[model samples]
Target: MSVTAQTGQRDGTDRRAGADDGREAIARRLITGSVKRSYEPIVDLDWDSAPVPGRYFLPPGALSLVGTELWNQMTVEQRIELSRQEMANILSVGIWFENLLNRTLLARLMSADPAAAATHYALTEMGDECRHMVMFGRAIEWSGARPYRMVLADRIVMTLLPHVLRGSLLWVAALIGEEIFDALQREMLEDPELQPLISRLMQVHVAEEARHIGFARDGIMRRKPIRGRWETFVAGHGHALAGVMLRRLFTNPAMYRRAGLDGRATARSARANPHFQDAQVRGFASLAAFLEEAGLMSRVARYGWRRGGFLR
Candidate 1:
């Protein structure tokens, strides 16, 4: 992966044969995957069943407080309550980002040919995202934790980015939001102690997002435009900055208070917690490597990746 490989991905310069597939092959594969293994979360999960007593909404290891002093100070019940709130918080973030993704996909479709395989798969993915939004909303409600509005930072980022994000940058943004969460959910799905409902929800989400991630990753490799220093700088830093925003999106200051902890102090502790940072970095490793291979990581953006706690 050299500079020329990155910038030369445009229409014609030079690429391994089949440069102009427009991702028809990737799209066709994704469409087949969707047909065989997609989920309708509403029908797949037993939404009416009562939650299992003493089961955790999130796996204990995934909790932000897991390795903190506060975790040791807390009782099992308190930790479970915190996990419940955290689960709701994560669902809320999922809803927020899925809305952005659906909107971006629809906007892109405005110019896409309806007959294209890529276009058909984009529609299929949007359908999955819609189901996911509804699923997350219901799951949040079931958590018994109140949903909160998006944070100021996220609101600002969404407002500013949608006007400019398209093609490779849009897909990169999608990957930033999807990959780690998908990884986290997969791990959660394997946890014997996780609440059954949450596990099922994760199962459905993980299955569908696999296709979405494939689509987005293909889009990035096909369209990563690194020709100009300025364009590369924006794409690199923008992707890194989206990762930073995602970290904040997963937390809500008010969730701590609702969970009976000191909101601000707990937030500070979680931000500085080595356990949480290491966990995120581990989940992010594969995606980072893909971006590095795709030539999306600019020098300064690599700096941002470290500072953003996504590459450490």
Candidate 2:
């Protein structure tokens, strides 16, 4: 593919219409094919892989209380159900990102002058995501669980919408998604009860995600601002949409249902109950703090943690 700049635009004006757009398409196509390529978990991973000695997952002073409280609140059956769902969510993480990476490659391939550097990065990312899927899938299987049914929100964001937006949004969405995983993975790796296989999987994932987070930060920062009033309006709406999708994942109905609460009722309670307000509040606050600590709060426009109490 050609690497020369296209005609008609001034220096620094990104005239590559399809650089972001086409790259996403190319990425999705690649991911579809990659997913079809299979690997055997039992054959590849040692079932007896010894756990990494000492706490390797949780960050110091990280709020384990929240997760413990949330889990403890649920009945025994609820805990098992939620555990299954959580495991599925964990396994799906890499699979979903792999799909996004594939779409991005497609977009890059379609660009008028594709950046070799970007394509190379995408290839590495594709491999990382594949490894992540395998590791997570094996962890789930080892726990005697199958992947959870795709919820409506997941179907919409992870499944349906990647085709509609440009690849840039994928990176934007990814920045949020990966950061969440990075945070959680860090915590899980430290967990005493955590299986050795799961800890190793998280460790490997965190290593790869560090690069992805950097790429997403740069990609989101390089985008042009929305120009006109209508464009600004649309951009605002887009932010709202993105925020809603994110909040939905955090406040997943399956999460509540698995905890023995009615999924819808738990969602409603989360919205309405003051006693449980800390769940949303503290969650966003912790996330915001992480963003600020990582110097990302200013990068993605202010996350809506201050006024709304939650991301919704």
Which structure among the candidates has the greatest lDDT? Answer: 1
- Tens digit of per-residue lDDT, candidate 1, span 81-127: 99999998888888888888888778888898999898999899989
Estimate candidate 1's alpha-carbon lDDT, on a 0 to 1 scale.
0.81
Position 132, candidate 1: lDDT: 93
**lDDT of each candidate versus the true structure:** 0.81, 0.52
Model 1 residue 45 CA deviation (Å) reads 0.4
Report how far residue 3 has shifted in candidate 2, in Å: 29
Which segments of model 1 are wrong by more than 4 Å?
1-17, 224-231
Which runs of model 2 end up more than 4 angstroms from their true locations?
1-45, 48-81, 112-115, 151-160, 224-237, 255-261, 266-312
Model 2 alpha-carbon miss at residue 243, Å: 3.5
